[model samples]
Target: MSEIRRFAAEARGGTPENDNRRVKDSVKRLQATVVEFNYLRSDGGRVWESSPLLSTCRIDERSGSLQYNFPSGLRERLVEQALYSMISLRVQWEFDSKYGLVLYETLKRYADRDAAQPWWSVKTSELRDLLGCRDKLTDWKDFRRRALDPALEEIDRLAEFCVLVIETRQGRGRGGGQVVAVTFQIERKPKEVAAATIRELEKPKVQRRGERKAKAEDIASTVDARKALHFLTGADAGTRLKWVKRAEAMGIELPKTASVVENLARWVPQIAAALVAEERIR
Candidate 1:
């Protein structure tokens, strides 16, 4: 129960009673859920399966512990899987809606393609099914406005990939010339930008007012320092620091009054250029 509580981002910062209630509610939902699995075999065969998500679920109120088990067949298949997608829990928890979360996961499966322009396409109805809103949003405009558009917007902001709606419609459209299919192009972020995004997401979701302000200030200062370092040196701070240590070993010294960047600027120009070029090549 404690581990589950810790793993659930939403359970954090709530009272013990509230957390316990939330956990119980989640368990009930899991036990009651019937999931369908559609697997495509290597030889072009398809496997369709439906089963209860959980075979059993038990809770001990006094002990504050919970126990659950996946259906045996589901467990076996999961354990024997040869390939799987890795989803980041922090990113998943940051999604404000289930539509966004589902869309993000669906897109992530195609993120590793080696194609020059990676993309995923599906019939509008199929996408609606994937998002579990097949019958709910009957109108195309309502579906796109209320579900698809918002989901795509959230994914573009929070996900590692910048998704763009590259194509829609195949032939003459039906249903008042509605969009029949949708396609999205996925592009991965640069390393530095992705790293910064990860750092931002890693911060606690709930923070005191003062703490949040302080963190914002600290992050701003860090960004400023990085920009300053980049301006002063051809390479980033990390690359320059590596060579700074090498410079110190070679008997190059900095005055007490000078900062690391100032001394680096004053160092042998040829050596600095060489170091920067080497770092770039690496």
Candidate 2:
């Protein structure tokens, strides 16, 4: 029973009789939350298990797009449903720390790359933009009321614990219950605070310039000189060798040039041949 029925019963002119049904209905709102959760667990499980290469699921706010970043192929299976879920959720509230991590982990399993990176580490400015509205709900009750309509049609807002329920003449079967109740919480972070907090969510770290230089050198060492020659030749073979020693050290097998004019004369054919071979030019 809702507090409304209890209040009406105690009042002098109150008609508690009709309140009986209203109270019963209100309680079911809480129950729907549980039902939605089960549905999500079941359906979400299927998506994850079936589509391993699909990762990086996001609910876009501006255009209300549910973008999925998958390795390949897997997205085609779920893209339509993913879009449906995104539309259903209405995404009234932004994802927070706990909920964000859950989504990140869930989607990461389907991603091609390492899913171990924390949600905060994903560096998606677009997501942050979506989350910008977190602190904007001034009227919680009004907001909840408006949100309830879509929740039933769309998604499971675990953080809010809300569901849209529809009453039925018989039992609440499929297509019987309209969206009715929900369990959702609203965050009231101030604009300044939310902005500051989100910024710290992805702070850039500084490293020594020398360290960066060394890392670059290390990366350079792994270059395949023969492969580079192949590419250069295909590109036109006329490209000048800026660093003769470095090219030679890279095993490019190119002659060191003391004179630019002489180097260009010889370099063009070498580059053109490499290009031809790359293209399998007979």
Candidate 3:
């Protein structure tokens, strides 16, 4: 239960009881969900199959543990194929909507392609199905306004890759042209920026906000100063020097290694608390 809450970014800030309720709701939804798969075999034969997402689910409130199993048929094929997407839970949890999350995953599938310009085009209907908004946002205008636009905004802001809307209209009619499809050009961020983004995501929510506040106040001269000491301990010499410089700039005298080691028990927790509150307002 604790692990589930930690990985589920949305649930991390909630109370234990609320988090448990949310987990129960998610488990129930998964148990009730049905999935369909269509496959083409090497001999040109086709197979269509359907099954519940989970065959069985059990939860023990007293033990605060949950157990579930996938449908047997799907489990066998999954084990045999071993095909899956490796998505970052941290990034996925940052998305504000399901559309953004789904679209991010869809684009991630093509992130490894060697093409100079990687893109994906999907029919409006097909996209609606992928986003699970087929029935709700039936109208193109409503769907684009409420779902597509917000999703694109979130993806561009939070994802490691940004999406460019290459095309959307096809036929000439009302509103300039009828919306028929969406084509997205996937552009990966620079290596350094992407690495920094990953590091930001890995931080605790409060610490991240604190760092942002510190930056906003211009209190820290170097970005490396905001990094926790533990992270710098394993970093290269240049990185460690930047942290030391940051401390010096803050009017703090550096203690020798022997003195620091002797006072570790007294100062470690205080250092952690200071880091958390350094950028706090009032």
Which prediction has more favorable lDDT, 1 or 2?
1
Candidate 3 residues 1-282, lDDT tens each?
776766574555544453477777888898889887755688989788889898778877778688999988889777763344577887887766889988988888776577787898888887898888978989887998999988997677577887888557767887768788879899898888788767767777567557657865565423223344444344466644554555556655566541243333333332333443553412
Error of 1 at 2 (Å): 4.8
Ranking by TM-score: 1, 3, 2
Residue 269, candidate 1: C-alpha displacement in angstroms: 56
Q: What is the C-alpha lDDT of each candidate?
A: 0.72, 0.37, 0.69
Q: Model 3, residue 185: what's the lDDT?
A: 92
Model 1, range 41-133, lDDT digits (tens) per residue?
A: 889897889988888888887787788899898898778734346888879987777899999988887886667778998888888888999
Error of 2 at 126 (Å): 29
Point to the candidate with the largest lDDT: 1
Ranking by lDDT: 1, 3, 2
Higher-TM-score candidate among 1 and 3? Answer: 1
Evaluated at residue 24, the lDDT of candidate 1 is 78
